[model samples]
Target: MAHLLEGNFGQGSGFNECLSEHVLLTRFGIGINDPKWISIRLSLFKSITLPGVVSQNTSKLGWFIFIDSSWPSEFISDILLATKDFEFIKIIKVNFYFEYYIISEKLIAKSIDFYGRCLVSKIDDDDGISLDCFDVLYDLRGDFFACVFSSGYEFLCQNRIFKPSNMPFLTMNTHFDMRSLDDLKYLRIGHHRVAEFIDKERRNLHVQDEGRFWVYSRHKYSDSRFSAVRKSIVDDKKSRVISSADYHHFSIDFSLLQEFRSQSALLNGVPNEKTWLRQADLNEEAEKIYRQLVSMKRVIDEVGADVIQ
Candidate 1:
C-alpha cells in the first residue's frame, strides 16, 4: 500500500557531502487546532516519541520541533515546559498561514550553508525513532539527497493497551535534507516517502531495508489516511507485547507511559485495579479514561482546565 504512493513526488539532487550534523526536523501537530489531536500528541510525546530521541546513542544530531503559533497558549506552554528539559530541541511556532511543507523546505534552504554536511529527517510527533536511527542513517547516507528507511515497528497504542506489531515495513525514517520534504508530497504518515517531491525530474532514491529503524504508532487521533481508526493492522494474531530486544536503541520504558495513563485515569476518577488492570472486568477501564481525555480535550481552548481542577 505504501508503494502505491511511491514515485509520486519530486526527487532531489544526490548531493551527499560528509555531514557535520544530522538534524531531526519534526512537526509536532503544527497547524492542527483540533483539541483531540493536541491531547493525543501530548500524551504520545510524553511517553513514546521524545524519550527515544533524548536516549540516542549518537549525539551528532539536533532535534528541530515545529508547532503552530495559533495553538492554545496553554497547549504550547506545556510543550515548551517539557522541552526545557531537553536542550537540543529547538521549538519553532509557524504562522497561521504556514503548513508543514513550507516549514520543512524553508528550513532546508536556510540550512544549506550552516553545516558542512546536513542530514535532515522528519519524525512524527506521535511516532519514535530508534536510538541508533541517526547512527545508521548517517553512516549509510553517502551523497544521496535522501534515504527512506524501509523498516520499523508498529506500536498499537490505543485504549491503554501497548501492542507491538510482529512485522517490518510498518515505519520508515527519511532524512538528509529531509525535514523540508514534509512540504513535498503531503499528510503525516505518508509524508516520509519524500522521494517524489525533490526538485529533480528523475529522482535517485536510495532505498535501504534497515529493519527496526523507527517505530510508528496508532491511536484514536492519528492524522493520516487512517484518521482515528485502525487501518494498518497487517495481522491481528501476530500482535504481542514489545520485548526488550524490540528496539535498537532502548527498550520502551513503560514506566513513562504508565505515568501518563495513570494521570489521565485519575483525572477521570477511574478506579484503581484490584489485582491488575488487565483483569477481564477492569480491563480497558483506564484505557477509556485516557481515551476520554483525548475526546474531552478536543475543545480544550474553550473548555479551560477547571473540569480537571
Candidate 2:
C-alpha cells in the first residue's frame, strides 16, 4: 500500500481529486456507446471565448490550436491535411466565438515601426493604394498573421480563450532588446583575456600555498602576459585590474558559493555546454562556467534564488 501510494502520488493529484469529488460521475453513467456524454465532459474542459468581451490582460486565448514550433514544416502540413475535417474548425470557432470586432489600428502601427512593414491598410480608393501594394504589404505581414492564427488556434484547442497576443496588431507599441554592435564586438575578447589571466595567477598561488618542499617551478614563469593583454583593453580610467585571488575568494564566500553550487547543479546534464566546450574549439570551459556563475548572481539579485530552492 505504501509503495502504491508513493507511485501514484504526483503533482496536481489534489486538484484532480477535488474536481472528481465535485462533479457527479453518476449523472453520466459509464456507457461505452454514448458518445454525447463523452462530448459534454470534453466540452467542460474546453476553453470558451466570448465575442465583445475585452479579455483581462492575463488571458492566454486560443494558442493551443497550432502545431508545435519544433515540429518540421512538412509534418505540420501533413497534420493540417489529415485534420481538414470541418468539425475541427467548428471546435475552434466554438472555443473562440467573439461577437464584437476589436480594431487595433494602433497595434498595427507599432508592428510596422518595429518590423518595418504594414499589416493593416485603409480600404478607401482615394489613398492611391493599388492591389499590388496591398499584396506586397500582406505578404510581408502574412508570417506575423499566421503566427497569431496558429497561437490563437492552439489556445482554442487547449480550451482557453482570452489569451491576448503579446504582439497585438493595430497597437503601435513594441518591445525589443537593443544592444550596440560595438558592445557585442568587444565583449568576448574582453571577458576571455580577463578571466584567463586571473585563473593562471590563482593556480600559481595555490601551488605556493600548498607549502611543498620543492621550489615552485610553475611560479617562475609570469602569467603577466595574459594580464597585459587584458590591461590594454581597459580604455576607461575608472577600470581597474582584478586579480584571480579576488575572484577565487569571491566564489568561496557563503553567498556566492551557494549560488555557484546551484548553477552547477542546474547545468549538470545540459548537452549544449558539452558541445560548446568541446566542438566549438573554445578551450575555456572554466571561464564559461565562471561567467554563468556570475550571470546567476545577477538573476538572484532580480529574483531571490532562495525562492527557487
Candidate 3:
C-alpha cells in the first residue's frame, strides 16, 4: 500500500513529527517576526511532489526519487521517510532560491558533482534601486566553481535583480560579467549548457532600460576575461581542487565586501572605473556585506559548539 502526507507537518511528537527539529525550534523559539527565516527552513521541503508506486508481494521494494534541483541531506531524509514505500518515484521539478549550500550538500553527498561556471552580472532594473546580485565564480586556484550569492536579498546596486517575495537573495560568484542576452546565449551554446535556462524572452520584456544597457556592456566586459581565467585554471598543474566543504567555509570567510571585492578583482579582474565608482557611491553595500559575513560565522560557531557538546 502507498500513503502520502503533506502540509506544515505541525509542531508535536509522534506522527505529527514530520518536520525537522531545527524548524520546530526556530518556529516556536524565534517566533514569526521574520518571514524569511520561516521560508529558509520550510520552503525547501514543502514543494516536494512525489508519486508513489507499489506492487503486491514486494516487501523488498526500493524506490528512486528524482528531484529537479538538489536538496539538502536532512530534507531528503525527511522526504524519503515522509513518502515511504514507492517502487518507482519521480520528483517532477523543483525551484531553489538563495540556498546553494543546501543544494551543494545534497549533490556532493550523492556524488553528482556539477559546477555552474562562467557567469556574469548585469543590471535588471533601475529606480536608483539596489538589488542583490548572483553569479557563478570560478576559483582558479581551486579549479572549482563556488556559487555565492548575497547573504540577504538587500538592494545595493541600482540595476540588479530584486529578491522575489518567495525567494532568498542568494547570488553566485564569478569573475565574468554577464550583462547581455548575447553573453548568456554564448554560454548556453557552449559545453557548459545545462537544462536550466533563464527564459530571456520573458526577462527582456520586463527588465528596465538602463538594466538592459548594462547587461549588454557586462557581456562585453566578461567574455575575454572568462576565457583567460578558464584556461589558466585548467592548464595550471598547481591549481587547488576545492571541495564542497571548503566552498562552504570560503563563503563564510569571503562574505565581507573587503574580502569579496579584493578576491573578486584578483580572480576575475579589476572592476572598471564605472563599476568601482558606482559601488563607492553605495556606502551601505560594504556594511551589509560585513554584517552578513558576521552572521554566517556566528551560525558556524554555534553549529560547531553544538557538535562538541
Candidate 4:
C-alpha cells in the first residue's frame, strides 16, 4: 500500500490528469510544499498511518510513501527520521511529471518477481486500518479479485467523536491473479469505481459490521466539502467518544493526534488570505460538475443505457 503526500502523480498523462493536479493545488491554497501543510501531514502520517502498519499482525507487507521531489531538505529529513525505524516503509521521491500507475505496475512486478503473486492495497494518509488487515489479505492471496473491508468509522476531530459508518468501497486491494502486468484491464482503478469497472464475480466486498476495522479521520485539512457534510451528518447521529480501546485496536498514538490538532491550530490563518478565496471558485466548479452529472442521469433515466451508449 502507498500514501501520497503531495506526490506529483498523473502529470505525464492526459488533460484529465492536469485538471486533477490543478484542482488539488487550488484546494490547498498554500502550495503543496508549504511548511505548515507538510508538517501537519507528516505528523499525521507518523502518529496515525505508520502506527497502524507497524502494529500489523504480520511484518511482510511493504508501505511505500510518495512525496514531491522538490520538498526542502529539512522536510525530507523529518520524514526519513520518522520512517527510519521501520525497514518495510520506503520513501519514494517523484518529479513533477511522474505517472501514478507506474508505481502500481512497479509494485506488482516486485511482488511477482519475489513471490510470483500480487495483492496491492492503499490507505489514505490520515486513515488507519485494523491490525489484522494484512493477515486477512494474505489468507486470500490466491484469489483473483478486488477486496474491501467496507465497514468503518468516521472520526471527527473537533469533538473527538466516532460515528459508525460504511465508507464507499475504500480501503481496497486488487488481486490480479496473474503473474504478469500485460493486458491488465483492471489495474488499480479508483477505489470508489472498482465495483463499477470490475464484474461482480471478481469483486469481494467483506462487510465487517461487528468490529469496525478501519478509521477514517475528518479534520480541517482534508477536503472541506466532504468533511463538512460528514460533520453535519455526525452532529445529529448518536456518536461514541473515542477511547483507548479504539486507539489500541488501530495501534495509533492518542497523544500524536492531540499534537496534530495543536499544530494545525497554530498554522490556521497563516496562509495568504487571498488563497482562501479559491474555496469560492472550487465551490462554483463543484456545482457545475454536479449539475452536469444530474443532467446526465436525467438523460439516462429518460433514454435508457443502451440509447445513451
Please report the candidate that would top lDDT against the real structure: 4
Q: In terms of TM-score, which candidate is strongest?
A: 4
Off by over 4 Å in 1: 1-20, 97-103, 159-172, 177-202, 223-235, 247-251, 259-309
Question: In candidate 3, which residue ranges exceed 4 Å CA deviation?
Answer: 1-49, 52-82, 86-97, 109-309
1-309: candidate 4 lDDT, tens digit per residue: 222333333222322211110000101112255666677777777777778877875455556665657678888887777777765555656542122344545555556566655555666667777787666656655554555666777777645788877765764322234355652445545556667766654454443344467877766665546445455657755678888888888787888888887887675433333322433554457546656876999999999999999
Error of 1 at 27 (Å): 1.9
TM-scores of the models, in the order given: 0.63, 0.13, 0.16, 0.70
What are the runs in model 2 whose C-alpha is more than 4 Å off? 1-184, 187-283
Model 1 C-alpha lDDT per residue in residues 124-203, reported as the tens digit of each score: 77788777766676677665666667766566664432344333223336654433433333334344334445434455
The candidate, 2 or 3, that scores higher on lDDT is: 3
Q: What is the lDDT of residue 268 in candidate 4?
A: 46
In candidate 2 the C-alpha lDDT for residue 262 amounts to 41
Candidates' RMSD to native = 15.6, 30.2, 22.4, 11.5
Q: Of the pair 1 and 2, which is ahead by lDDT?
A: 1
lDDT by residue (tens digit), candidate 2, 40-158: 22222111111001121112111112111333335334333433431111111110111001112222233334445322211110001111222222233323211111111001111
Q: Tell me which residue pairs clash in candidate 4.
A: none
Best of the two (3, 4) by lDDT = 4
Q: Model 4 lDDT vs. the true structure? A: 0.58
lDDT (10s digit) by residue, model 3, range 222-299 = 234544444544455543443333223222121222332333343434223332122232334644564587688798
